[model samples]
Target: MTEFLGSVWWMIVSLGLLVTIHEFGHYWVARRCGIKVLRFSVGFGKPLWSRRDRHGTEFAIAAIPLGGYVKMLDEREVEVHPHERGQAFNHKTVWQRIAVVAAGPLANLLLCMLLLWAMFVIGKQDYSATVGRATGMAQAAGLQGGERIVSVDGRSVATVGEASMALTAAAMDRHDVTLQVVDAQERQHQRVLPLSQLPAGFDERRVAPLAGINWQFWLQPALVDRLVDDSAVRGVLQPGDLIVAVDGERIDAADQVYPAVQALGKRGGPGMIDLLRGGERLALEVTPRQGLDGNRQPVWQLGIGFSESHAPAYDTVLKYGAFAAVPVAIGETGRMAADSLGMMRRIVTGSASLQNVSGPVTIARVANVSAQRGLDWFLQFLALLSLSLCIINLLPIPVLDGGHLLYYLIELVKGSPLSERAMAAGQFVGLALLAGLMGLAFYNDILGLVTR
Candidate 1:
């Protein structure tokens, strides 16, 4: 229950920050354009906290953290006073109104770029796609284990994340995928493998499949970074002691240790844990406690934290100087943008599933996990999330920035605003569409939780 509440808290914080920033953009731009803003709200529904500034704009924090809005004075409303008509939003020039509408998404994009820049400047470690091992079963015939995949089809991959994405793109079509791999002996090999059968309840709309062989690299094991009183890990494993194995199985890599420990069931007591100290292996008992991953899967945990000193064998380290990171950050931002646009195109073409859409739950889990990892990881994730937010808001859907932009474009061409009845109809359609999309996203979230 504590962990669940913690997750909810993190979700609220993340959503609140992003939505506030987004709304601030509109508020700031509207004020700059000599428009009379009535209310600048963070979140939606009834305001939980509000203050009226000297300028007469109500600054508020609403109940729902899902989104926010900037309400402005408009003469189109029946309650508009004659004295306030000059400051109405509808009195603004078409360009000024467009600027106000465009500011929100632009702010999100800028925020993303800044976050990306900060992440690169601070330096975050990432694992390269250098393959360590690839197990061969009858399902994965014609591919040898331990071959490093350099590229899929013709696209060169530098990191594991990129490789995974490439595979997902290729997997959309039911076809054999070609891979370029380097063996341990330094020999490069080209191999073609057929796609494996997918699992049941696998929502293609929600997730893409791997196009090529999925490989795993070794990660450093979790060590005791911090200990809480009465926690299972503190009573068993101490700081400076390396976790060597769980359930008598040899812990070859850090990635395997956690799952191994989690897999151990209680036999009327705490499960046995093997540890390695200064060249000595010791046995200790630890009770497995339930924990949740980003996907909210129930896993066993000893309740200890890990330090950053343990470097895994498969890590291909790259260090960047502060000044040198600028170009890298720019390139990364561009790549992220391109990737996002490509995914959207794929989805529209029916090559990608609509299940790719993630709601607030997924976002929060991702943010929390990234925060746990490190500041750099968290910032990078935030940058990506910001970009996603910007792009999504810019989509030409009603009740969004893109929708308003479309309306402005029509006004520009027609030399007049859209009729009030037409605008109302558009709003109705837009609201319905937004509601339907939200429902689908929430449904997908529930389905994900159930399956996991």
Candidate 2:
């Protein structure tokens, strides 16, 4: 029950805050354009909290926190007083109307930039970009594990995050990506990853395991199979965990784990092992059980089995000053926005899975996990969610801010507003599209719950 409530709380806070940011963008822009703002709401449904400001705008916090709206006085929706006729939203120039509608999404993007700036200024862990192994196309390209990648497609990639962006962009663009790497023996090689033959729906992440490319370089080749019931690591470690770091030392290969484990157990009251499951990294402390060895000497062990495949982990931390962070954040936001748009385009073109759509349940789950990870991670998560919200709202579908802009564009080009009946039809079609999207999102969330 506590866990459930925490998830719900995070979801509400995250979604509510994001929606408020979006609505405020519209409200601020509308007011600046001299429109009579009737209401500024932070949610939908019944108003839980309401207050009319001195400016005549009714500020509200509504029951449903999933979305919000800005209600501007429009002659079509309400009878306008003679004195207020000039301030009616419908009376505004088409360009002004377009700006008002577009502001909400633009606000979201701006918010993402700010959030990212904060993240970069504060910093989160950082790691060098190194290859773990190769699968599928990577193997065909002669890429090997343990190589430190120097660059991708002429872009210097000092970190896995940077490498990932370049790789994904190249793969999605259907272009061969050139990788300059120094192999384990310090021998330099150039590998051309043929992206033309890359699977349609495979994103950078999904391509990793199959392509034997571990950009994060945190995966250990030996997979943890299980723990004995009475073992020291029984509860601390789980099956399928990939050992990341043993004690305080990072392991670059499976063979390196033995020396670290032995050194830690020799003088340690407790042995620390950092592990990765899915995308989450965890640290566990265990006291190895001592037993007689072949020479009748005592040997300490953590009762676990290993498998052939590797377990992966990732960590990064790059900090900058306020001024320095701004450009980096903007660049990061642009790349993420491009990635989000590309993913959407892929889905629309039937080149991507609709199952990628995430809804409330998925958001709640991620929010909870990220919150548990601490503030830096949670803030980063929020930024990404904000970016996604911005992108989705900007999609040219009716009933959305983008839809209003689309209508306004037509009005500007045609020199007249669309007929009321035609506008109503557009709204209905927009609602239908949104409903279908929501239904699909919910279905995907439920399916994820069942499968995960």
TM-score of each: 0.72, 0.76
**Residues 325-373 of candidate 2: C-alpha lDDT, one tens digit per residue:** 9999998888778778878886788655687788999999899988987
lDDT of 1 by residue, 42-158 (tens): 888999999999999999988887778999998776478888777888988999999999999888888887787788777666766664434442125445545666887887776
Compared with the true structure, model 2 gives a TM-score of: 0.76
Global lDDT for candidate 1?
Answer: 0.74
Compared with the true structure, all predictions reach lDDT values of 0.74, 0.81
Candidate No. with top lDDT: 2
Tell me the lDDT of candidate 2: 0.81
Question: Which structure among the candidates has the greatest TM-score?
Answer: 2
